[model samples]
Target: MTQVALTISAEADLIRVRQVLRARCQRVGLGLVDETKLITAGSELARNILTHAVGSRGGVRVEDVARSGRQGVKATFFDEGPGIPDVDQALVDGFSTSGSQGIGLPGSKRLVDEMTITTEVGSGTVVEIVKWRRDRSWRP
Candidate 1:
């Protein structure tokens, strides 16, 4: 697996995240659908990082994984925020403590092949998502 990691801060980083993901998708020859999904998912996670993290910054890491003649991208977000008090409730559709769009987490998960999150009550959060290339034989 190959990994790309970065610290996320300011609104500009939001756009940067999408750009980086799109570039990686292109580098790995991912299709438009896959690229779009990565962009959307990246945006959502970045939004959450900005909104909830407050004074702290977050990190986003993207990795390339190969298996079974297929390639997948894994994106992970780490934040030093107040963290989710209730993971189950936060993941449920239409349930948001911040009360914004409430679609960031759930929507992001729907766009990826796998999604996992972990958080501490007073520490921070880590969200990881993976998207597999559409073509099984695809490679960079």
Candidate 2:
């Protein structure tokens, strides 16, 4: 298992996150489509950290994982900013506290195989997402 952690303190870090995620996804043997999905999701989350968590500590950890002979990539985004007051509402398609398109969280979830968010009103938030490589041998 390989792991890399990067801090998201500026706009440039978002690009770095995408680059690292893309490399890790390719190393895990994920195809172009899956890699794109994961990188998009990671970019959204990393941007969130920069946009919403400014002046606070935020970052993402990307790791290569394997389970049941399946290869996958996992990313965990964390921040020490004001946490989401309403997680359910935040997950809604059109809910936005910052007045943007409000698709970051929900859209990101759709791009990954699994996603989970843990947050507190005052403490902070942690979002973990995983995308598993498609098994080429499977047939309908």
Candidate 3:
């Protein structure tokens, strides 16, 4: 089940995107902590898109995925910016090409159950993040 899909052109639109994601996650019975993590991860990725790919547009997609007969929330952020040249270095903590705190990739990886990055120089970047439903708890 896909819940939220949004595109942001302005940096200010990123906040609204995050809010929509958080609300959609909560409505689906994802834990509060999980919702926060999703929003934070989305914010970081969206911010990167805005700062690096300004004047371009990007979006976040929220989906419900089934695994081992269970379901979970899956979120993806995509941008059509100058793709990362070095994916290995890009994943390292504090290794930003930009003069900013470099926790976007690694930090987002830690927040989600799984993450995957795909990019091509002069093309774009796509980051997919997933958080599986934990059987130990059910919000609904």
Clash counts per candidate, in order, are: 0, 0, 0
Name the lDDT value of residue 19 in candidate 2.
Answer: 94
Candidate 3 accuracy as lDDT: 0.80
Candidate 2 clashes between residue pairs 3 or more apart in a chain or in different chains: none
TM per candidate comes to 0.93, 0.94, 0.89
The candidate 1 region of ten consecutive residues with least summed lDDT is 131-140
List lDDT for all candidates, in order.
Answer: 0.85, 0.91, 0.80
Q: Judge candidate 3 at residue 25 and give its lDDT.
A: 72
lDDT of 1 by residue, 46-115 (tens): 8899999989979899877677787877789999999999888887788877868688788888998889
Q: Using TM-score as the measure, which candidate wins?
A: 2
Per-residue CA lDDT of candidate 2, range 22-137, in tens?
99888878889999999999999999988888799999999987778787899999999899999989999988989899999999999999999999877889999999989745
| lDDT of model 3, residue 92 | 92
Off by over 4 Å in 2: 136-140
- Per-residue error for 137 in candidate 1, Å, reads 1.6
- Candidate 3 segments exceeding 4 Å error: 1-3, 136-140
